[model samples]
Target: MTFKHSIKTALGGLHSNTSRSILTILGIVIGITAIMLVLSLGAGAQNLILSQIQGMGSKTIVTVPGRQPSGPSDFANVFLDSLKERDLQSIRNKANVPFAEDVMPVVFGSVRLSYQNETYQSTVLGGGSAESNNVMSDIFDIYPEQGSFFTASDVLSKASVAVIGDKIREKLFGDIDPIGKKVRVKDKTFQVIGVLGRKGQVSFFNFDDMILVPYTTAGQYLLGRKYFDRIIVSAVSEETIRTTVNDIEMTLRANHGITDPEKDDFFVETQADLADRLKTITTALTLFLSGVAGISLFVGGVGIMNIMLVSVTERTREIGLRKAVGATNSDILTQFLFEAVLLTSLGGLIGITLGSSLSFIISFIISKFALASWSFSFPYLGAGLGLLVSAFVGLVFGLYPARKASQKAPIDALRYE
Candidate 1:
């Protein structure tokens, strides 16, 4: 009888039933804290959506405006009035393919900007040329801490000139200096030349609550019409992203006259198809929350097989005084399989430290805004898969109650009572 005296007589029979070994290790500590808080909140929401899609410029390529998928009101009538400007001059005559510098055409809405009396509603867009502010300075890398971003003759003279963003210059010039201020917006005004810089935020896109303007004052006085919902191109390198997406899909399928390419309406997409659609939606939500944390480790291995069948019916006279003192049958089946693998490896090390502190409090509420930074270590591959599957589910449910308390015997367990 030695594997350290059968683990100090199976931890002195679990400290003489300390509240039934803490209620049979509360289902392996709630199935290893719900599979380590669903694999650390699905690997911190796919590392904060691949760091906000590589901070919005993963070799950018977007295009939108694709309808007739047969429904959803054909993507709301291709978002009303289906994309135009000769399909943005068939993406600027596929600007002779390869490393085709920039290409624009955006169009957007949501108004109410104001100033004196500080209004703030937001979102305004418009853009195009001044190489769409170098594709919004490589998708919000930065530029304009306060003035100047419009020119391609200020979008060919529709100039009311604008650029604002750092949260609409702190809700209309707070720390003052919003260039040569003027604000207003749909009701017309404008002027605040520039102020972007601080670009933070992605999912729920808040590159500092926008404003921009220009594409001819969003096609004459805020969307009077002249359609365009998306288009932002940009290549200049990355080895001419597949010959600039096959010359902007063969110059928008020969300027929308569409000689087939699935009846071309428009709809490109790249960055390796947005990182395989966000790693197939974070690997199907981390295998559906690790199959609901493997049903709480299969209900904590059926509560360690019903407390090792009520510890072989309350230790029949201590297995007949350890088989009348000679102690054999593999030392009472290794003291009830080392007291059900030391109570499910101390309930899988306190459910991997309370599931890695609930995936670091949901990655500190999404790193307050710069997105993704969720952590989850303690994965010695989930602590060697919770110590070899909670000690092989306590040696297969304490092996038929430790082989029925080592095959009964020393005279029917000293005539069990």
Candidate 2:
């Protein structure tokens, strides 16, 4: 039989039992759908993470108050009081770190902020002199929409000044002007010196919901700790970042009286290092999830094989009659194989459509409500792979049933049913 004739015969047989044909391909549809969803969502998540990391700037480096964590058991080291006033002073000295351009000690905690009867629970970021605030503004590409950032004098005197986010202002002050107002931060009252713009997120921080204050005041009054959680350092240029990181490391090691590199209390990470680490993590997670989704495809292939075998048995009489009417074994084989491949390929197309639609809807919901930075991503490679895999499953699974049908003796098959 011609290839076209075989395809026509295969299609006609499937049409005779449309319901069964649809049921037979359901497994393929589901498997492909799962794969596409996983791949599209994974790509979107990776993009969002990378974009946020970029907001920190390539010339930036951070020093955390602990050794690099090797496992969950060592994670507590991250909260240690290793970065103190002495370390901060040493890092700021140009002689000690010639390439360093800016440094800010950071501390943060959750607090209930109130304006008279109005109250809201939010995070308070304690860091920055006015110069450092400007550095932050430049780095994040956001500035106060109303009023101004706290002055350098604010840090020196531990002044009761606070810069609130847009959400903080809305929740506490309503439509009233927030600048120059007094708000209670934990036990102390602070004057609202500035209000940041509606920047949704930057470097994984939701600036729209945070409050900023001088680290001195935050340490002495709010968290009641002299040590900082981390120190943010900026290099004069991107090219100097490596030298600056080395300089900062040497300075800190000497200041802490650390003679051995492995015994160092603090850890430093540049933006490139952080980006690479996060990318590796995201890539690994995506691959793991994709592997889990792949199990569905294997299950679907088994289902197809089982159903095809049942189909061969049910059509035994038809196979025998075709063989009795001048049909060769090769012709019968081609028809059955064509049916299997067509069913799976059709199911694959349907699955790609359904998965893409669902992924887009989910991406929209997440971007609109949860995170503005999130975006929809289409997995072209995944769609192509899904189609090819579905077709391959049909070929492998349908072979046994096709061979069984073709090898049937005409006289035996004709009399059996």
Candidate 3:
């Protein structure tokens, strides 16, 4: 028989057992859907992180207190009090770090902000100097929508002036003007001088939900700690990032009296480094989930193999009749193999459709509810891989059954039930 005739006969055989065919392909459908969903979500998460990192610009460098965390056990280093005011001052000296364009110390803590009867718990960010305003404006593109940022005098006087985020402003003041109003932070009333424009999360920090204050004020009055959590530095140019990082390392080491690089209390990271780290983390997670999802495909393949074996047994007489009438072994093998491939291919297509629809619905719901950063993505690569894997599974698992069907002698098959 011709290849087309074999395919036609195989399709007819599947149609004759419609219920069984549907049941047999269900496993494949589930496996493909899981794989496609994992790939789509992974891609969306990676893109969100990369975009956030790119938004910060390439010239930015961050000096974080504590030893660089290398493993799960090293996470305790994050809470260490390593960076001090002396390290900030040493990095600020242009004579020592001429490549540094701007330096801003950051300290953050969760605190309650109250305006009369309304109270909200939110993260409070403290900026070390007036230059921090410019740093935030330039690197993070933060700008005041209603009023201007606090001036240099505000930082020097350890002023109780504050800049509120968009969400914070809405929750506290509603439609009323926030400028010149007072908000209570840690028993201290701070005059609202500025309201920031809508800036979403960056590097997992939700700017929209945070309030900004002077670092001196936070250290002295709120957190009551003199050490800084982190120091942000912008290079004079993108080309100067390495030099500035080196300068910062040298200055910080000297100030902290550290002789060995490995023994240094702080770790410096560039924007590129941060992007790479995030990408690595996301990629690892994607790979691990994909591996777990792959097990379903294996189960589906086994299901296909078992179903094909049953099909061969049930259609033994039909196969014998076809062989008795001039059909070759190759023809019988092709017919059975085509049926198996068709089953899985159709299942893969259905799975792709279902997975894509579900991914879109999830992304839409998350965006509507103002959840974490998420985007709907078409899993093109996942679909392609799924299709190829389905075809491969059909070939591998269907081979034994197809060969067994082809090898049965016509007289023996006919004599059997």
lDDT score for candidate 2 against the true structure:
0.86
Candidate 3 clashes between residue pairs 3 or more apart in a chain or in different chains: none
Model 3 lDDT, full chain set: 0.85
lDDT tens digits, residues 153-263, model 1?
Answer: 778778888887787787677788888878778688888878887766653356578787777677779768788777767787677777787788777777667787766
lDDT of each: 0.74, 0.86, 0.85
Candidate RMSDs in order: 14.5, 1.9, 1.7
Superior by TM-score: candidate 1 or candidate 2:
2
Cα miss at 225, model 1 (Å)? 26
TM-score order of candidates, top first? 3, 2, 1
CA deviation > 4 Å runs, candidate 3: 76-79, 128-133, 371-373
Tens digits of per-residue lDDT for model 3, 79-158: 46788888888888899999988888888999999998999999989884764446667766678898877766688789
| Per-residue accuracy of model 2 over 230-281 as CA lDDT, tens digit each | 8888889998998988988899889888999887788899878887888888
The prediction achieving the highest lDDT against the true structure is 2
TM-score of candidate 1 relative to the true fold: 0.41
Q: Report the number of clashing residue pairs per model.
A: 1, 0, 0
